[model samples]
Target chain A: MKSLSLKNLAKTYFDAYKGEHVTAIRDVSLEVPAGEFVSIVGPSGCGKSTILNMVAGFIPHSGGEILVGGTPVKGPGPDRGVVFQSFALFPWKTVLDNVGFGPKMRGVPKAERDAIAREYLALAGLSHAADRYPNELSGGMQQRVGVVRALANEPDVLLMDEPFASVDAQTRMTLQDELSRIWEERRPTVVFITHDVPEAVFLANRVVVLSKGKVLAEVEVPISRPRVWDRLVADDEFKDLSNQVLALVRSA
Target chain B: MERTSRISAALIFIAPLAVLVALWAVVVPVFGVRPQIFPSVPAVGRAGLDSILDGSLLRHVAASVSRVAIGTVLAVLVAVPLGILMGVSRGVSAFLTPLMRFFSVLAGIAWIPIATLWFGYGFGAIVFVIFNAVFFVVAYNTLLGVSTIPMTLRHAAASLGAGRQAMLTDVLLPGALPNIVTGIRTGLGFAWRGLIAAEMIATDVGLGYMLFVARDFYQTEVIVLGMIVIGTLWLLIDRLILVPLERATIERWGLVSA
Candidate 1:
């Protein structure tokens, strides 16, 4: 695990239809210490996804320094693994192969990568799905594969862009619980982006709220470990923190 | 259960052809049609038997099949990589797309006259025609396949440390495979027709040549037999090879929506 720092990150693009340059992210800077879970939440078009995309190196930042473990990032690399909202688990590959892809890219032998894949699949409770294609699995199951696929790479930092947003509510809660458990176990630095307020608070140690391409505020979650919806749904602290972040997002 | 269903499907498919043959048997003699116009079923059957007994049918079929096989293989080998290269670059695809559209429309028999000029009237000319028939379609389809791949998949691969080589093999190749297969199927369809035409004009030892020679002698029986062989060969190729290939990859992998 390694610390991720964004120094004056900005993104500006020319909108062909609008016939003008529009800034998506303007002067955003933040620091995520090693093994920390930080979520960036915002309303639509607030650049939350843009920030994650930039950090993941899917798009270039207009201006900024993105450093992982104090080394500047030039492009997408194994040091920063990303879990996309689409689940992006290669449809042509079986669940096991999809999870094994990272190790395979790193030159791990077939036997070793398969073993590594099995271990991560076990972590996500996806062992039974190893032989199945992504399309064969449910949306929730596919995202589980996505999560573990990133984790199996053992990257310095994991970037999740609204990973659970597409799944249904019940599945989202279950995924959130599983992600929290996984974070507690592995303690990998994660920067999660989402528009869902409670989901941001539920999964992150700190929630950053953004508005109009700028950071508005940050709320810290002091929730205890092993958090689950059954216990936290009605818990006062969880509700308060969720409401606090929701208010920040709404106000933004 | 699956095997039985497949057998039943085959039987259903054959039923109509069987009925058409039976109608041909009755209609020809009942009308007392001249053999020169349309040979009786028995005459065509005897022609088929004569050609097979003389080993000419096998030789012709082999020549035609081998030419098609070689041409398609060579075309795919070249077209797939070229298509992928075009797919990866917007400028390349944009510039080549219009050319691909024009050439694919003019692919097949249109190339035969020039092919014969270039390669002479023989196997080379026929195969050149077949190659042209297959190449443009496959390349165009491959380009379409690569371009249609979701950006997120590439993002996931790159972030997972996929380098240039790995991205091409692991992501682009497999991701574009379904379309490539589809292209091969469609291109082969065009190539099969082109092969018959090219063989008639440019070759002395193929099914199309057999038909053309029979027409000179007014041997309608041999002509009808050649037509049946051509149609049956295509059916077998499509059903026995292409469909199963599609099922094994595209359908089995759930790449295609229901």
Candidate 2:
């Protein structure tokens, strides 16, 4: 059974200044089963981020519906947690407070919230930075906080939008490994969106390619878990999938 | 060059003041001006010491400071939350902005005649003037602050499971802090000026009254002394308190110079 479903999802931007409408997503639909790591790959400004925002309910979709566990997603709730591209940690809050913010909003007591946050912090390998502010950390470290903050609530589905896009190559690789490890342990349904083909192939069980608000293709990665991206770069299956995805992204 | 000089530059500013003072000490005598018109530096200093010794100076200073303190505190306590509430909602911000800006322009000295008429010539009248000076300015600035916080940040918080209250406490307040503090400083500047003007016109006590009373007695020395005290007090508040607080807020979470 599908854990998350998108049905006839459409989004349009009304250009108030120009007196026109632009369609970013038009009747697009996809589904992710429970505990499956799915990543959506798309060209820039192709409504990939908008798709995620639709799922997270940060923006009102111009039309259609999104469902998680058979209930319509109207607005943001603790059931689905989102990690933003920019790692939008509350600058005034320490890592602990930021991570615990989900539970704190749910009216969880301070002690219980702290315990949950502590568990996620440890899972993210960021226990030492719990008391530090976001500004005090590097880009990769900031994303770690973002990830922990989302997972602290023990969300049913974790949503990530170009989460590692800002990090350097070394940091991105390390973060991918961390994400892979986290997925291996928690088994939460994840819907990650990225433009980078190699990243999608390295992490996702299924890669959905989108172009002009439509799903172009959905390919399943046959690679085994505990991925070593560097080693996998030499594997024939990895190379072929990467080349195909790269060509598709480049053409679109 | 601007950065380096900002780091090292000080005391060059003192030279111009020293020259002005030296010219003051010599110019009056050279021009044969009467002491009543322009008291000598030594005479002003002597009056300053006299006021200090008699304890009247301290009382007047305390009175003015206390009124300003009470008024500004009350204004911030009231203004910030109200401003944030208005700011969070499009309907409220649009509805209140014109009204708030209208009143901000009418802050400080403009309120004097009505304030005195309403509250009578005492602490109430003086506080009313200061409150008017602070309330609208701070409120307007706070509304602006909340509005300027990026929409994406608020949405991000919401997606991360932050509710309405958490969004306010975490994102809204902190993001608006630099502007809020800036508003307080500017508001208090107008407040201090309003306090002095109100005190002169309506109150029997405080620095403005001290200066005005000195004028009645042709005590130019005391008048000069009062002006000096006002300048010094303002400088202290700006340098030691408001400026540092503003700097800290901007450094921690402030928007860039854009």
Candidate 3:
């Protein structure tokens, strides 16, 4: 695991429809120390996804320096793993193969990679699903695979873009719980992007609220460990933190 | 239950062709149709028996099937890599797409006349026609398949440490497989028609040649037998081989919508 730093991040693009230069992200800087879970929350079009994309190296930032473990970010690399909201599991690959894909790319032997995949699948509580195709699983189950597939690579930093946004509310909570458990156990640096206020607070060590491509506020969550929706749902500290982050988002 | 349904489905498919044959059997004899135009069922059956006994039927069928198999394999081998190359590079795809569209329309039997001129009216010519028929459609569909893959899947693969070769094998290839299979099916449809047409014009030892030569001699029974063999061979190839391949991969994997 490694720390992530974004210094003076800015994005400006030519808008074909508007026929003018549009600035999406304007001068934002943030740091996520190694093993810390930082969730960036904002309303739609606030460039939250853009920030994550830039960090993941999926898109080039117009002006910025993104450092992962003190190394400059260039393009997408194995050091940084990404979990997308779309649950982009390879439909043609069985669950085991999908999870094993990263190790396979690294030229790990078949038996060793399969073992690694199995271990990760167990971590996500998805051992029974190993032989099935992605389409055979429900949306939630697919996302569980997505999370483990990323984790199996053992990347230095894990980037998630609204990973739970598309699943049902109930399933989302369960996924959040699983993610929290995984993070506690593995302690990989995470930069999670979402629009949900409670979700941001529930999962992050600190929540960074953004508006119009700039960080509006950063709030620390002192909520105790092993955070689950069951307890966090009724916890005053959790509610207060969520409300504080919600206000920052709304004010933005 | 599945076995019964499969049997019933086969029966349902065969019923219409059986009825057509029955209608032909009754009409040809009852109306006293000229044997020169359409031979009696028994006459056609006799011709079939004679060809089988003489081993001519096996030779013609073998010749045609081998040509199609060789041509399709070569076309797929070349087209898949080219299509993937086009899929990854916008400049290449943009330049080639228009060319592919234009040539695909001229695929199949249209190429036979030129093919014969180039290859001198033999195996080369017929195989060229079949290759021409299969190549463009598969390449174009492969391009469609690769382009249609979601961007995020590529992103995920890249972030998971996939390099150029791994990206092709692990993501682009499998991601494009459903369409590749679909393309092969459609291209082979064209190739089949083109093969018969080419064989008629160029080859001396195939089912199409059998039909064409029989026409000159007014041996309508032989022609009818050749037609039956051609149709039956295609049905068997498509139903037994291609459909099952499609079901085992794309359909079973739920890659395509029902």
Candidate 4:
């Protein structure tokens, strides 16, 4: 069974102010097998985030369904975790507490949840920041905490909506490498959304190109792991896949 | 270093008041101001010392402080929960907002006549005025606070598997706290003024009563003493308590730099 599946999902809303119907996404279907990394790339208003929100169950699809581990998603649950573009770290909570929040919500015991939070914080290279508040950290560090926070829930699938878009180029590259390393270790089925083409090609097992709220292409990246920035850029296979994804984005 | 900074901060507050006192001491006698209009600084000080020796000053201070403490505490306890309930539902908040605004604006001294009639003279009337003054303003501010929380933060909490109770304790309460504290500060300002006014009309053993009674004999020294007490008390409450609380809440819960 596919780890995460969107079966002909569609989202439509009436713009009450404008007095017209708006279709954000339509007829979108994709299956992400367990432990696979898929990146969805599109233009700014192409509804990439709308589709991701649907999968995370933050919004109900106007038509069709989303399933995680073959169970239909009724609403947001522990089975699917989301890392938002805003980082969304609770400002009042320390880094440790923010990471521990998911398990605490799930009724995990204090000692056990604290230990789990510490473990994930260490994995994200943020154990040193356990006592620090979210605002005290830099943007890149905050996003890493955001990622580990979702990971701490032990979800079957992780949904990311432009998680790296706000950081600088150097920080973005470092975060990509860190994310790739984490994904390799945890192997949770992932669906990442972004407008950065090279970033899509670099991080995803398969790139799902979106244009005007529709899936334009799903190109496979056969560039072998363990993936690193400089080495991956030098490989011909990486260049070809990046070019193909870029061409599809431009043509749309 | 921390101690020096703390001492300097205290000095910063005290320096201006010291200058004001020096100016008053020199100007009052030098200008030959009539004793009936304003007492000399030494005369007011002697009146303060006499009240302290007789113990009426302590009684009046205790009565005023206790009434304020009781009314404000009761108001906060009730207002916060009701505000959260109303704020959680858009329909309820919209329906109640106008009503709350009307009542809050009508709070404090405007309620004095009705409150004195309803509760009668003394502690009941004064406390009632203080309670109404605090409740409506705090509730309105709390409603605004809870409503202002971004929807995305709530969604994130829900997706993380937070139940209704957890959401309230961990998200809603903490998120609204900065506003609640701010509300308390603002409301207390209204309540303090209302307390003095109510005490003048309805009570015989408060700072306000002391000031009012002094008017009968034209005891400028006693009146000046009462005025000094009122001003000093308000400064202590605002600077020592409310300001620090507001600062701490904003530092802890508010978004960075907000």
Per-prediction DockQ: 0.88, 0.53, 0.87, 0.69
Q: What C-alpha lDDT do the candidate models reach, one value each?
A: 0.93, 0.87, 0.93, 0.89
Q: How do all the candidates rank in terms of DockQ, highest first?
A: 1, 3, 4, 2
Tens-digit lDDT string for candidate 3 (B162-257): 999889998999889888999999999989888888888898998889889999999999999999999999999999999988888898778777
Q: What lDDT score is found at residue A63 in candidate 3?
A: 96
lDDT of 3 by residue, A157-194 (tens): 99999999999999999999999999999999999999
Please list the residue runs of candidate 2 whose C-alpha ends up more than 4 Å from where it truly belongs after superposition: B1-33, B254-258
Candidates in descending lDDT order: 1, 3, 4, 2
Of 1 and 2, the candidate ahead on DockQ is 1
- Candidate 2 clashes between residue pairs 3 or more apart in a chain or in different chains: none
Clashing pairs in 4: none
DockQ-wise, the better of 3 and 4 is 3
Query: Which residue pairs in candidate 3 collide?
Result: none
lDDT of 4 at B139: 89
Which one wins by lDDT: 2 or 4? 4
Q: Can you write out model 2's per-residue Cα lDDT over B116-220, one digit (the tens) per residue?
A: 889988898889889888888788788888988877678768876777777888889988888899999999999988888888999999999999999999999
Kindly give the stretch of ten consecutive residues in candidate 2 chain A with the minimal lDDT sum.
A224-233
Error in Å for residue A167 of model 3 = 0.8
User: Roughly what TM-score does model 2 have, to 2 decimal places?
Assistant: 0.91
What is the alpha-carbon RMSD of candidate 4 to the true structure? 1.6
TM-score of 3: 0.99
Pick by DockQ: which candidate is best? 1
